[model samples]
Target: MAKPNLPVFNSPEEQFQQLRKLIIERIIVLMDSNFSSLINLLYRADVDEFKLKKALAENPDNPAEIIADAYIQRQLQKIETRKKYRK
Candidate 1:
């Protein structure tokens, strides 16, 4: 047997673009009532600001891989200093 060819994005940008489509596709599938509720019900979502933007921008059905929100949360948390949240 040979190794499978897993889809590997060229860079973070590519991943974000793809992620966005996935998020929106999932959202549509769920007929998401609200953003928070959608987030809560998602089995897993790679929710990044860029991805969210892209998802909301495109048809969303183009991409098929949706990374969990947990991943995005972790990425947003890794920093040397804290940042202020917008109100």
Candidate 2:
């Protein structure tokens, strides 16, 4: 019998990086075509408004990267909290 193809698994760090790149791309598209949607997403994702604004101001040329990093950090925080509570 032929062996079946299996999905490749990435390390956690690699997976996170891939997700971060995807998020940055999406944020860039939203910035160009629908900025309000990006703002709404940031708010919904629980990214700190003050920090995001500050980061954007500091990195005026790379707002997408800043926003994506903030979003990912928030998600990681939530995961940690959940793990802590579950234990």
Candidate 3:
């Protein structure tokens, strides 16, 4: 039987780098899933998709800020609908 070959890291730093990369990739996947859910909620609430995308770009590094923007947008949409029907 032939032994399977696996690449070996030569130093602690190299192993750490590999582990860190894996962790970051997993985090990114989780973030994507959460963001998708947020977007869907915003859409169902009648929030503008363009505005949400702009907010995300404006706060590229802050997920909380993006979420706040989504919530605010939903509120604004609700207010607008109320005003429209009150006429």
Candidate 4:
């Protein structure tokens, strides 16, 4: 039997992020096994949230959309923070 080896990263923070992403994927898979709608809605909400942020950055004059986007982004942040911390 041979021992397996993993690559080392110069930056621990970057390594942490890569590991975090893998964990999040495992979580989404688990969620899909049960609450599929929740998973889908979360995915769509994230995409919309990102688009809104980009729009706000690209067009600061759009007050209405900016406000809506800020609200959605905040809500998503809260949800994600809660979910991540709970795990």
lDDT winner among the candidates?
Answer: 2
lDDT of each: 0.52, 0.84, 0.62, 0.56
| TM-score rank order | 2, 3, 1, 4
List model 3 lDDT by residue over 42-81, tens digit each: 5677767787678778878865546554665577678998
lDDT, candidate 1, equals 0.52
lDDT of 2 by residue, 1-87 (tens): 233343355687776677677788888889899999988988898999998899889889988899999999999899999999998
Candidate 1 vs candidate 3: which has greater lDDT?
3
Clashes of 2: 0
> Comparing candidate 1 with candidate 4, which one achieves the higher lDDT?
4
Off by over 4 Å in 1: 1-6, 32-87
lDDT of 4 by residue, 1-87 (tens): 233343677898777556545544544554447566544554655546566568768887753445344445656688989999999
What TM-scores do the predictions have? 0.35, 0.81, 0.45, 0.32
- Looking at candidate 4, what is the lDDT of residue 33? 71
Q: Write the per-residue lDDT of candidate 1 for residues 1-87, one digit (tens) a residue.
A: 233344689998887767665654665555544566665554343346576557646644533333344344545664322454431
Comparison by TM-score, 2 against 4, better one: 2
What RMSD does each model have against the real structure? 9.5, 6.7, 16.1, 11.5
